[model samples]
Target: MNKISFMLNGEKVSLYVEPNDLLLDVLRDKLGDKSPKYGCGRGDCGTCTVLLNGKSVRSCLILAIEVDGQEIMTLEGLSKNGLTDLQKYFIKHSSFQCGFCAPGMIVTLDEFLKKNPKPDEEEVKEAISGNLCRCTGYVPIIRAVMDYVKNRGG
Candidate 1:
């Protein structure tokens, strides 16, 4: 096992991980955060998305040991005191149906909006292109993101 240290949900965390263990496994099996689902398990599906240093990444594509000293943010970290504005907007717009891809979509959208606060429709779609949702057909998701941006005066 390799000892890895990283920041999770704004708190410093350290744990032992097997060399072959994926970040998704460590986060869910070890850290007890199940939001990053084990979908596809091959990185094609973005259901396991997380933020590494404020950038969206597929946790299933990364080894637990590779994240040493990095700052990781899961869906749980996005809400400070309660539901974030984005989260509220998503719910208000019914962006999620089955909710399988909500966590990754939210994290990806959060990172995207941070960089491009006023993203065009295409830009918004491109930002979440990595994530695949079988529900809502993506229109509602895009609308929710646009609404959030508008509400924030971006």
Candidate 2:
């Protein structure tokens, strides 16, 4: 095992991880942060997406050691100050159904909104295009994103 340190949800964390351990596994199994779920291990499902250095990335595709010096943000991090505006909008619009993809979707959306604070519907859709959601049917998700952008906050 190798010791690695990084900023996780604004907190500095150090842990021992195997070189071959995937970030998703480290977060979920080792750290007990269950926000980033295990879906398609190949990284195609996007259910394991998380913010790495303020950008969205597939945790499954990243080795735990790769985040040694980076900032990692999972969905749970978004609730530190209570529910954020984006999260409220998600709830207001019922953006999630089965909820399995909610964490990744929220993490991805958090990064996307930061990059494009005022994004159009198409842009919002494009931003979360990397994530896949099966239950809500894209309509509600799109509406929530667009509405959140329109409100600018709340």
Candidate 3:
């Protein structure tokens, strides 16, 4: 096992991992952070998405050791201080149905909104294009994001 250290949800963390271990497995299994779920083992499903250095990335496609010194943020980190306004908006709009994809959707859009504070409906759709939500039809999610942006003075 190779030793690695990195920041997770603003906390410093260190662990031993096999070189081939995927980041999603390390986070959910080793680190005990279950927000990054396993939808598809392949990178096609964004359910394993996480923020690496403030950018959205497919955790399943990344090796655990690749993030040794980088910063990683999961849904847990995003809402460490309680529900954020974006989460509230999601609730207000009932953005999710089965909720399997909620974590990835939220994490991806959280970073999207930070970079593009003001986004149109098309932009919101594009931002989440990589995330596949079989339920909710993407309409409620778009509405939630747009409403959140408006409420935040975006």
Candidate 4:
């Protein structure tokens, strides 16, 4: 086991993890942060998406040791009091169904909007292209993002 230190959900954390353990496994199994789901083990699925230093990445493809000293943000980190504006927007727009892909989608969208606050339809689709959602058919999801951008004056 190797000791790794990182910031998780705005808190400093240190844990012992195996060299081969994926970051997603360490976060969910060891740290008890279960928002990042286990989807395709490969990087193709963004169900395990998390933010590392303000950028979104697939946690399943990253080893726990590789994240040492980094600032990691999971879905749990997005909300302070209650649902974040984006999350509220998602709910207001009925952007999700089944919700398996909601966590990854929300994280990815949050990062994307941070970068491109006023993203157009095409850009919004491109931003979440890496994540796959079998439910909601992408319409309400995209609409939710657009609505949030409009209301935020982005």
* TM-score for each candidate, following the candidate numbering: 0.97, 0.95, 0.98, 0.98
TM-score quality measure for candidate 3: 0.98
Per-residue accuracy of model 2 over 8-93 as CA lDDT, tens digit each? 89999999999999999999998889989899898888899988999899999999999999999898888888898888988999
Error of 2 at 14 (Å): 1.0
RMSD of each: 0.9, 1.4, 0.6, 0.7
TM-score between candidate 2 and the true structure = 0.95
Residue 118, model 1, lDDT: 93
Which is the leading candidate under lDDT? 3
Off by over 4 Å in 3: none
The models' CA-based lDDT, in order, is 0.92, 0.88, 0.94, 0.93
Provide the clashing-pair count of each candidate structure: 0, 0, 0, 0
Sort by TM-score, best first: 3, 4, 1, 2
Q: Candidate 1: lDDT of 105?
A: 93
Give candidate 2's error at residue 127 in angstroms. Answer: 1.2
Per-residue CA lDDT of candidate 1, range 77-98, in tens? Answer: 9875788899999999999989
Angstrom error of the Cα, residue 100, model 2: value is 0.9
List runs of model 4 lying over 4 Å from the truth. none
* Deviation in Å, model 3, residue 132 alpha carbon: 0.5
lDDT of 3 by residue, 122-145 (tens): 999999999999988999999999
TM-score: the better of candidates 2 and 4 = 4
